[model samples]
Structure formats: C-alpha cells, structure tokens
Target: MPHINLLPWRELQRKQSQNKFVTILLLVVLVSFLSMYMLSTYYGNLRDGQNIKNSFLTTEIGHLDARIHEIRELDKKKESLQQRMRLIEDLQSSRNLGTQIMDEVAKIVPGGVYLTKLERRGSAIHVIGRSESNNRLSTMLRQVQNSYLLEKPTMQGIIAGEKSSRLLSDFNMEFYVKPFDKIGEAKQ
Candidate 1:
C-alpha cells in the first residue's frame, strides 16, 4: 500500500467550509443593512408628503376663517340698518296722532263749555274748562263718555268762578284716550 497524507487533506476541507460560512454571514449582514436603509427612505418620503398636505389644509382654513369674520361683520351692519328703518317707519305711522287727538277734542266739546287748558300725558287727557252752568258741565261729561276716542271721564274738582255778572263754573277733568284699534269697536 502507498503511504497517503489524509490528515492534511481533511484540514484543507475544514478550512474551505469555514470560509464558505463566513462569506454567507457577511452577505446576509449586507443584505439586511440595505433593506433597512430602503425602508427608512420610503417612510421618510411618506412623512414629508403628509406634512405638505397638512400645510395646505392649514392655509385653506385660514382663508375660510377670514371669510367667516367678514360675513359676521356684514350681518351686524345689516341688522343695524334694519333697526333704523323700523324706527323711521314707526315715526311716520304715528305722525297723524296729534291731529286725530285735536279732532276728537273738538267733537266732544259742548257749546256751553269752553276749554282753558288741555294737556295730554301718555293715554290720559287733562282738561281744565269753564262752563256756563253745572248742567253744561254734566252734559260735557256725558259727551266724553259717549265719545269713540275718550273714556273713563273723571271730574277732579269743580268750583264757582269769580263773582261775575254771570254764574260760571271752573272744572278739572281727566279722561283716557282710547287706542285707535279700539276706537272703532267702542263706537260700534
């Protein structure tokens, strides 16, 4: 039999196997590092895109807020103008009140009764007058009660006037003016 060196051959085989394992390990580590870098880049791009969208939305919201503020101001101005218009309309509608009151007084006065002072406060009319006689004052009171515009006639006081040639009576009276809406109903 020829003498063969099997030990050296076995040792060479072992070294080759060790080298192959180290090469595979290094390849695996390199591949893992590349995959990690690629995943991080992808996530960073997504984050940047979301940030841009958020900034756009914020700008749009700011514009909408400005418009809302302007709308509120316009509404306030509109309400103020409406109130002024309503006040003017009310003044115009009540313009004939004084004339109506005077006409009513003229119609209610009796022939023998002369009004000296006529004062109106709110719904109450205060009348100071001189009458030819007590009967004339009583007739005036009855006229006031039957008037469409007057009601609740109250005689405050009556006194004999100065000792003149003719007997005269001074009287103070108060009556409430009926509201225009009720005047027609009262007459009916």
Candidate 2:
C-alpha cells in the first residue's frame, strides 16, 4: 500500500468512459439519420409510382371519353338517316294517291252523270256535276260509296236546270278518299 496517487487513475478511467459514451452516441445518431433517409426515399418512390399509375388511368379515361362521344355522334347520325328513310317511304306510298282517285272517279260516274268540277279538301272531295235524272245521280253516288278509293258519298245540293235544251239537274256532292293503306289492302 505505497502512496501511488489513485486520484489520477480514477480521472483517466472517467475520461475513457466519457469518450466511449460519446462514440456510442455518435453511432446511434448516424444510424437514426440513415434510417430516416431510407424511409423517406422509399415513401417518395411509392408516391411517384402512385402518381404514375394515376396519370395512366387519367389518360385512358380521356381516351374512353372520346370514344363515347364519337359513339354518340354516330348514333345521332343513324337516327337522322332513319328519319329521312321514313319520310321517303311516306312520300313513295302517297305518290299514286291522285292517280288512283282519278281512275276511281272515271269508273264510278254513271253514263248520264257529268262532273263539272272536282276539288279536293284534305281527305274529302267536293264534286259539282249535272245529271240527267235523280236515279242516275244516285247510281253514281252508290258507285262512289262502294269504290275502293272513295267512301262516304253525301249530296250537298240539287237544282233543276236546262243545258243546251236538254234536261239536266245541277248537283253538288262530297265524298272522302279512303285511306291509302285501306285502298291498297282492298285492291289486293
């Protein structure tokens, strides 16, 4: 137990412990910083990937929207063409209506009945005529009523008149033209 100065040895031991503690603290701090950087970079990459996917979806959606618009336009055009076709069909069906009416009138008039004027009003025709006898005029009316292109013969007026020293009765009559579909069906 000689006097060797234990205070200096204890002081040196304290300094070494303090240095070791500092080194371990520095190591812990470096490891924490590296981990935080790695985590942040990984999250950033994930965000970038998500953004790319979102952009792709957006572009595809825009393309699909454009296609849908084109489809709508095509549908409208098709509908317009269909309407035009229907109009043409209607015109074609009614094309022979006037001819049919004239032919029917020629067949329906009796020999003693003369038609002076025939005027059309929508689906009805007003006829001005002179007849030799009431019986002849009535026969013409019966024929008109029974015609495939005519219907509903009605007498409007009758007047006794002299035409070129011949006995004639001036008369006014009305009749309806039969529907085109019905006329076609009846002829068939």
Candidate 3:
C-alpha cells in the first residue's frame, strides 16, 4: 500500500467551516447595528419637526394676545368718549331748561311779592321771599300752581313774621318744578 496522510486535510476543512460561521455572525451584528442607527435618526428628525411646529404656534399665540390687548384698550376709549358725549348733552339740555324755568318763574310771581333766596334740590324748588300779606302769599301759591313751569305745588310751611316797620312780610315756600318736554327736546 502507498503511504498517505489525511489528518492534515481533515484539520484544514474544519478550520474553514469555523471561519465561515464567524463571518456570518459578524455580518448579522453589523446589519442589526445599521438598522438601529437608521431608526434613531428617523425618530430624531421627527422630534425636530415637532419642535419647529411648537415654536410657530407659540408665535401665533403671542400675536393674538397683543391683538386682544389692543382691542380692550380701544373699548375703554370708546366707553370714555360715550360718557363724555352724554355729559355734554346733559349740559346743553340743562342750559335750555334754565332759560325756560326762569321765564316760568317770572310769570308766576305776583307784583308785590319779592323773592329773597331760591334753591333747588333735584326737581324741588325752595323759595324764601317777602310778601305784603297772607292774601298775597295765597295768590302767589295760586299763580305757581297755574304756571306752566310749576307742578304739584304743596305748601311745605309758613310762619307769620314779627311786627316790623319794613314793607316786606317774611315767608318761605317749597315746591316742585314741572319738567317740560321742550327741555328734553334739545337732546334730540
């Protein structure tokens, strides 16, 4: 028989099989690492996009807040102007009322009676005056009742003055002034 060594060849074949296994394992590990890296990059890009959207929304909210503040200021100014206009209208109406009231008061006063002091509280008029006698006072009350400027005249109080040489008698009266439509007409 011829002398032949097969042991070395068998050892070489085994070594080649081990090398193939190691190469396949290394390839699997590299593929898994690449997949993980790609997934992480995709998630990072998604987070960056969300952050950009949030910033844009924040800027829009800020602009809306400013507009709301400006609208509130304008509303305040409008209210102030409306109040001022109302006050001016009231003043103008009162100016015309004063003239009408004075004319009515002049027409109601008797020739002999003289008014010393006149005061007004709301719609009420308080008059302190001197008259010749009680008859004159009665006539004055009647004149006030018949006057177009006075309404619901109720005698509040009356007192006889002490004997004096002065031609004037002492008396005081309070009544309400009738509001006329003409006074309110000026507002229109």
Highest-lDDT candidate: 2
Could you tell me which residue pairs clash in candidate 1? Answer: none
Misplaced by over 4 Å in model 3 are 1-28, 100-117, 121-124, 129-156, 160-171, 175-188
* TM-score head-to-head 1 vs 3, winner: 1
Give residue 75's lDDT in candidate 2 (0 to 100).
100
By summed lDDT, the worst window of 10 consecutive residues in model 2 runs over 160-169
- Over 1-188, each residue of candidate 2 has an lDDT whose tens digit, in order, gives 69778999999999999999999999999999999999999999999999999999999999999999999999999999999997897689779888878988999998988999999999999999899899998898899878988999999999998767469889999999987678778889
**TM-score to true structure, per model:** 0.56, 0.54, 0.52
Instruction: For candidate 1, give the lDDT.
Output: 0.87
- How many backbone clashes are present in model 2? 0
Error of 1 at 35 (Å): 2.6
lDDT of each: 0.87, 0.91, 0.79
**Best-first order by lDDT:** 2, 1, 3
Q: How far off is residue 42 in model 3, in Å?
A: 2.0
Give me candidate 1's TM-score against the actual structure. Answer: 0.56
- What is the C-alpha lDDT profile of model 1 across 1-188, one tens digit per residue? 47886989899999999999999999999999999999999999999999999999999999999999999999999999999987786567457767878998898888888999999999899999888887888887898888877889999999888867356788999999887557656757
